[model samples]
Target: MSQAPGLGIPGILHTLREYLVFYSGLGLLAGVSLLWSVLALPLRLVLPRRWRKQTGRWVITMGFRMYLRALSIMGACHFDLKALDTLRGESPMIIAPNHPSLLDALMVISRSPNLACIMKSELVDNVFFGAGARLAGYIRNDSLRSMICLAVEDLRRGSHLLLFPEGTRSNRLPIGTVRGSIALIAKEARVPIQTVFIETESAFLTKGWPFFRKPSMPIHYRIRLGQRFDPPTDVRGFTVELERYFQSALAEARLPPLSSMGARAP
Candidate 1:
């Protein structure tokens, strides 16, 4: 439950050591990613455009899984992702999750191969991620109208779309303010929205949280599926209610259930 720890000199050494491994692993993965992206370029020229997109997405999905697993093997983090894997139904619904850390997208996308997300316009031009993202047909968050249209079309085509309604990582506990775009996407697409809860014991990689100042080793992360809802006709009201649900979820997650609180006979 402690977001940050104060562990004097030992803490500083651990932080530095963990960050060294983190950056080294990140660099290695980035190189592999770049290579994969460049190699996929030929598929664009040879295969049908649609087939190329699918293949590119598959590559991205595999890469993500490998990257996360490598981090786990390196003793950087461990994940509780069983609940998230169960949410991967065949239906094309919106995946709305709270953004606690930068790795949230990687965690979600690794499990859903058919998922495309709304990413920052800058990433589309990023040297390492841009090529892969473009080849995978990920949407950019530049123009709202275009983004909505693309998202709806993707859903109609049976592709799952992931959205972080908060728009950015949480700056405080109990999640941050949710945006209306998620509701708008659901209403326009007429698809259900599935909420996913990402619980982390540490605030590493959160907004303004220094990446090098790592938390305790093998940082714990858990993904539990929240309630799924059909898009209501009232977009504004639905958005407000959605935000409230996430707030309650965070609060409830912090408390023990009544059944668990009772004494047990030995």
Candidate 2:
């Protein structure tokens, strides 16, 4: 009999490994979220307001850390996130980064335990994720003034604000236009912006990507710490400069394509 292209022992084993890693990644994410939901309910009732938010943030961080660890152990992904550890000793500030994939937030959160993320209103109201996010005191991005006030409060409470300056993922390469929310929050809170650059080669979870789609194995992701911008006095000017900075910084990064339209702004 003739030899088949992908029917050999090693090829079959490779295919099996990919499937195992892919599904396990999905399952682990849901597994952690569901587990957190169950645990958050009673904790909310028992703990005080401050304690609840603190505990919620800690547990979410640990859960994400473990999930990423599982993926690493399974040879499914490589995470170079050590750059974020240097910020542990720093004071509360906005942790700004480019949103490349859905995993962008996951990567940052897994490393920084005290980050208060800005979530979309709908996601904050999601049944599966709402409980934990609500309990964690994550800021919602529906109302501008409310979002800014809550973000400043979180910073005042000594939690790093996790803000994606792009506001959403870049549909094309390099980056999308940076929004003013980051600068405004920093100015109002009097906190600096700790810029982070997340570089990845996979398109697994970019905007509009399929939920259950399987990607290639051993996806490599690297995060680099960028310039720290002072609390801006000029929101509009800072927003313009911020976009230019991202355009210059990520000019060489291998960002995944978020859409097939080929570089149209959202």
Candidate 3:
């Protein structure tokens, strides 16, 4: 007997399997993450200052990587990265990437081991990322001076610090303005800035979206690391230069500028 004209049983079964795996993984991750956070709280409060924070961050980061791997195994998404060698075991460096999606932060951390980030003040209160963020000693984005100081100190202590120069997610379709804060931190710490750009086609986990929808098509990410440049002594000049560099990179990637989408400069 001939098969039906539409999707075959095998195809349908495959699709359903993929979906089940994706959602199930997400659910499992949520449950385990909650338990981990709760357990870490008391340890965070009772353990010695240094060890407590370090242990807590490691737990969160390792958990995050496992979650990402689960998603990859489900074939929900994939990433293409260039210049991976540059990031291997590099520390005392300010690694900056364009912020286009909420997942960008996780992507960066997953790629770089022993990495800390400059996160927003609101993240400090967020249940999902807050506890771990505090334990990791992520620099709060609210205070420029304080954040810079913290970043410099992290670098001094041999920790890699990742930053999003745009400060927030891009409102535009493409690249966003490069805030001067990153440049300032680089200069103050006397470190070179390692630039990275990420391009993703998945709209499921976007800038402000809360719901998860499986994409009709597979999502792909293109991540490239640009050459490191010495921080410019001329702060304003460096900002303009970095902004143009980001714009050009996005353009080359065939993506739109964040400014075109009404994204404000940070």
Show the colliding residue pairs in model 1: none
lDDT tens per residue, model 1, 28-102: 778987887687667667888878668778888888889888888887888878787776666889999888778
Question: Which one wins on TM-score?
Answer: 2
- Local lDDT at 191 for model 3: 82
In TM-score terms, candidate 1 sits at 0.87
Query: Looking at model 2, how many pairs of residues clash?
Result: 0
User: Candidate 3: where are CA atoms >4 Å away?
Assistant: 1-22, 81-85, 208-210, 254-266
lDDT tens per residue, model 3, 216-263:
434576778876888679889999998888877777563423323344
What are the clash counts of all predictions, listed in order? 0, 0, 5
Residue pairs in steric clash, candidate 2?
none
Q: What is the TM-score of each candidate against the true structure?
A: 0.87, 0.93, 0.83
- Candidate 2 local lDDT, 101-214, one digit each (tens): 888888998888888999999988876678899889888999989999999988987889999998887776678878888999999999999889999888877877777877
Worst lDDT run of 10 residues, candidate 3, spans 254-263
Model 2: CA > 4 A from native: 1-9, 261-266
Error of model 3, residue 65, in angstroms? 1.8
